[model samples]
Structures are given as structure tokens and as C-alpha cells.
Target: MKKNRFLIILTISVGLFLLSFSLSYQLITNKSEDNKIAKIENNKLENDDKNVEIIKEEEKVSPNTIIEQRILYKECGDLIVTNQTPSTDIINMTKEKYENYLTNKKPFLRVISFSSNKIVTWGEKEHLCNKHFIIGEEDGKIAVFKIGEDGERLLHKIFVDYPVELLMELDRDEIKKGIRVDSEEELSDVLENFIS
Candidate 1:
């Protein structure tokens, strides 16, 4: 009887030990799988964030876009002028309309004289002639002038603040006729000597 009892207790103890070992092994494997899944989820979130940043960068406006939207102007000392019409009008102006505008408009005059003694002479001719369109502002206000056949009849007032730019467009014919200036000084000299 003693031998039988001892064998029965030993059998029960061994069975309990094996069951506990199997349960522990299963728990460890499940914890490891959970960790791997969490890591994958974190990586996916990081990738998503990077993708969003790239999209935002692409949507930002570029300098070239801003430049394209604004009219191109030429810069002289404290003055900006353009031969072209206002940006809005130019966009809608037909070639025939532009030619008519030019034919009816008076020529613009600009003068700059820098002497050896540092004396500077600057002026402009904004005669009304037939060109009544408001090309642009001298400063921020509309540049107003009267029709004049000579520089003396042109206005000498400063329309805007100093250091302004003017935007102008020349036709192919005008360019062929030597209507282009290499610099502001050159433009001023040409205007001072212009016959028309």
C-alpha cells in the first residue's frame, strides 16, 4: 500500500510540472509576437508622417510663380517705368488693340544727366497725347501727367517714392529700330536726346 501511494503522488507532481512549463512557453511566444506587431505599427506611422511632409513641401509656392504673376518692370534711380499696359489689361489686350494703343499714345521720355561734378539731372515726359491708360504708379499713387511736345511741358513732380521700377514691353519693330536700353543711364540719355 505504501508503494502505491508514493507512485500516485509522484505521477500527479510530474503532470502538474509539465502543464505549468507548457503554459509559460505559450505566454512567452505570445508576448514576443505582440512586440513585433507593435514595432510594425510604429514604423507605419513614421512613414505616413514623412509622406505628409513631402506633400506639404510640394504645395508651397515658388519664387518663379510669384514673379510670373507680377508685371516685369525696369528699374531707374528712384523710378520704375514700363512701356506695357497694366498687368491685368496686358493679359487681355489683343495684338490689334495694342497696336492701336501705341499709335494713339505719345512716346515716353526719360532723362538722366550725371556730370563730373556729381550734378545729376533726371526728368520724365508723361504727356497725355493719346495714351491715357494708367500704366502703373510712380510710387503707390497713379502717375498723372499732361500732354507735352517738349521736356519743359512735361511734369517734374515725383509721383512716388524713390527707388521704383517701371515695366514696359517693346514690339519686334521697336527693338529693330534700336528702342532697347542696356541700363537705366542709357535709357535716361536716350530720352534726353529723343526727338519725338
Candidate 2:
């Protein structure tokens, strides 16, 4: 009877040891699956960062693009071409209208039509127009240009300091005061800089 009891206890201990080993194996397998899930989540986060970087690159737009878009929407009569076709009878009338229109107190950079109603003005700020349009530069002494409607395609410096109501009025008189008469040599130097 003593021997039989010892054998029964030994068998129970072996069974308990086997059960503990199986539980540990299951725990290790579960931990490995959790690590795999964590790795997948980390990869997803990295992909999200790459997508954000691409979106930022697409958002960066050039200044010229913004200016042209504004021109399309704004009432720009300053860029109107004086000579329009299909108006053989009204040609003289159109010229008279343009001349009377330009009898303002300040200089005009460009004029745009306001949806066929009236002309809109531009270049009221010294650098605003240049910064936006990038067409021309101050002739060191003075900036001058004879503008018409059709030259919109031509990239010229836009003078933004003109009056909103009248293209003749300037925002500041300092621009004129700063002008100095260029000598023939100075003029040649300025011309060379532009030509090159």
C-alpha cells in the first residue's frame, strides 16, 4: 500500500509539470503575435507621415500663380487692348473713350475691364504690383511704359501705386522725388543690364 501511494503521487506531479509547460508555450506564442501586430501599426504610422509630406509639396504654389488668378477674378481694365477688331464704325469712338479714360491725375501700370462694364485699376502699391506681376522694373531714375489691352500676354512690371478710382494719382510722391536724370552713359548702362 505504501508503494502504490508513492507511485500515484509521482504520476500526479508529472502531469502537473506537463500542464505548466504547455501554459508557458501558449503565453510565448501570444506574445509573439502581439509583437507582429505592433510592427504593423508602426508601418502604418510611417506611411501616414509620407502621405503628409507629399501633400505639403503639392500645397507650395508660386507667387505668379496667385497673381494671375487674382487678375482673372479682379476687374482689371488697365490691360485692355485699345484696338479691338469688329468695330470698324466705332473705331474712332473707342479711341476717344480711351483718351478720355486716361485723363487721370496719376500714372497707370495696367487697366482691366470689369466684366464689360468699366475698367479696374492696378499697381497702387510700389512693390505690390511688381511682387505680384513681375513685369518691369523702375528705370533707376523713372519707370515708364505705354500700355494697351492686348499686351497682357507679355510679362511686364506692374505699377501698383496708382489710384483705384483714377490711374493718374500716385500713392506717394517720393517715387518721383527719387528720380535722377540719367546721363547718356548711365542710360546705356541701364539698357545693357536689361538687354542681357
Q: Mind giving the per-residue lDDT tens digits that candidate 2 earns over 1-196?
A: 9999999999999999999999999999999999999999999999998888443222211222211112221222222222222223222233235434445532443444322223333433222121122113353322433223332323233334532233123512433332222244554464344343
Best by lDDT: 2
Clashes of each: 16, 27
Error of 2 at 192 (Å): 64
Off by over 4 Å in 2: 53-196
How big is the positional error of residue 47 in model 2, measured in Å on the Cα after superposition? 1.5
Worst 10 residues of 1 by lDDT: 63-72
Question: What would you estimate as the lDDT of candidate 1?
Answer: 0.39
Each model's TM-score, in the order given? 0.28, 0.27
> What does candidate 1's lDDT look like per residue over 92-127, in tens digits?
333344334434652232112211222122234332
CA-only RMSD, every prediction: 19.1, 20.3
Global lDDT of model 2: 0.40
Residue 55 CA error for candidate 1 (Å)? 9.9
